[model samples]
Target: MFKRLYCNNYRGLVNFEIELDELTLLLGRNGSGKTSVLDVMFALCRLLDGSAKVTDSSIFPERTLTRWQGRKEQTFELDVELDVEFDGSVQCVPFTYRLEVEHEEGGRKARINREILAANGQPLFRSDRGTVQLYRDDHSDGPMFLADWSASALARVQPGPDNRMLTRFADFMGRVIVCSLSPASFATEAAEESERLGRDATNFAAWYRHVLQENPGQVAELTSELRKVIVGLDQLSLVKAGLDVRALMVSFAEEGSKPYSLRLDEISDGQRALIALYALAKLTANQDCALFLDEPENCVALAEIQPWLMEIADSCGESLPQVVMCSHHPELIDYLGHENGILLSRGNGGVTRTSKLKDVSADGVLKLSELFACGWEQ
Candidate 1:
């Protein structure tokens, strides 16, 4: 799981650093850079995946850079620490990835000036204008030149027995899940099935079907939990729709009554949102990774908020996935108390600042909800 992150000169953030817990909650007003933080993280994922293009798409090579507005030679950097299991043991690996880009003529394109990767404060690789070098095994092998420049050198390097640390980092990055779900999308049929839940939850029913096929007993557990909060949500099933269509349909029945079934769209938006989130939690319950959620409380009802929070917490287990959720919900803050709440604010000349509620609440007397409700920013 990701333990800490430091981002510099990225979008609305100038310099940001925060330590993440098992279930870290980003709480503050909107536009304080909460979504920007997650977007940057997602951009980093795309960068490492070698999927970003040069100045063509939303992720990279110039779209993700902080708008310089004609400022000279701005750079974007991130220092991330992850505790990952490798060779049957867990280790905390720190990676410092930086990119230097210069805007081309007319601001339509950005060219890479420099890109570097350092692990545990030791330089492992560097790329200058697309030419790359790998400092193998702590530089004992000197710098071996690699040919890739359009992608991250760290992702390009093939890890051997000597560079198992790099392999672990790659594996951890592959498992990172960033979800920003849309309930409407959940009803749509997927073009192709996914091994894991999609960020938008477009393949939710297909993924849930896969989950149930792998472990049939999980439905009983899911139904038990859903029934507790949803009153009549006794069972869930995936049924065929038309020729090749499949959908997640819920069954509702009270004691001594015939059960009724409804498709996802037939249900209220709040119910659909809750069901998708619950399915996501269950699908990722046993995985060890980082899950970044953008405003999970969207479309959820006020009465079901507490139960939904509890269900999400329980799905994360005692440790795993290191959930980082962005929300402005007071109930969520109140339920998380103080330790898990990381407050974000735009201060100090329009830079996004961060501080944990644990630090803001003196004497530990006020609940996090009350602290925010009482205008803690003032």
Candidate 2:
């Protein structure tokens, strides 16, 4: 899991460090930049995987400067500590990936100023736009030139004796999953199996079907878990649509009545949202990845949200991907407990600030949620 994130001059983030746990919940009012925190991580993943196009015209970073403070040339530094199987043994290591970007020629272009990767506080590789250097076990491989300033040299470089850190970092970054739940995709007709769960779960039906096929008995387990919260939900099955079309269908029944079935759209939006999240949690239960959910309480019923989150929390074990969720729901804040809650609030200057609930002193009289409701400040 990610240990800490230090972001400087990135959008609403102005030199802030967020301490993370296995399951961190981002809490703030609307427009407080809670989602921006998650987006920064997503942007880094894209950059490490060679998918980010850093420029004045790009969708990400909308602007290089922090709007309120008028700061420019963002620097993102991240620390991730995880255990990996290395040399036939399990070893825990701390890895840091730092990236710095600057605008050139009066905002006409954006370029990378520096990129550095380190392990256990030792520099493994460091590069500037002009020259790239590789260090292995504390030895430098001299300076190597880069052809393109826009592309990431670390992402494009292949794994060799000297640069296994780059390979490991790239592999981890490639698998980080950031998603905001989608009900439309859940209700759509199946096309084919998905490569991975899309950002908005646009391929949910296909991915669900793929998981059912690849891991037999997994669907049955998911159905059993869903039945606990959604009392009437008996099972989730696939049905043939018009002609050769296929879609996911859910079946429900009263205590002594015949069962009825509904397609994704036929059900309430809240139901579809819960079902999609349930399937994703079950599908990724045993994988190594990072899952980020943005405002998961959007369509979910208030009463059911607690149980739904509890179920997801139960499914995520130590070896599985860690989950980070952004939510403003008071019940969600209560469910996360005081230790896991990170408060994000915009101050007078429109700059966002982050604080842990434990760090804030309370009277020991009010519940965590109550404290959050009353402005979190004494």
Q: Which tens-of-lDDT digit does each residue in 1-378 have in candidate 2? A: 788898888766777788888888888777777777877877777667777666624324436477676545778888997665666787777899888887654566777778888888887778787367777634456446664666567777777765665577777887787777777545467866654566677677877777787666567767887897687998888787767567888899759889998887788878888887777677666657788888777788878787777776775555355888898677887788576888888776777888776777767787777876777542
lDDT of 1 by residue, 132-182 (tens): 776654544445674554456667778776666556666666667777777
lDDT of each: 0.69, 0.74
For candidate 2, the TM-score is 0.84
Pairs of residues at least 3 apart in sequence or in different chains that clash in candidate 2: none
- Against the true structure, whose lDDT is highest? 2
Top model number, TM-score: 2
Candidate 1: lDDT of 348?
Answer: 70
Which RMSD does model 1 reach against the true structure?
3.6
Clashes of each: 0, 0
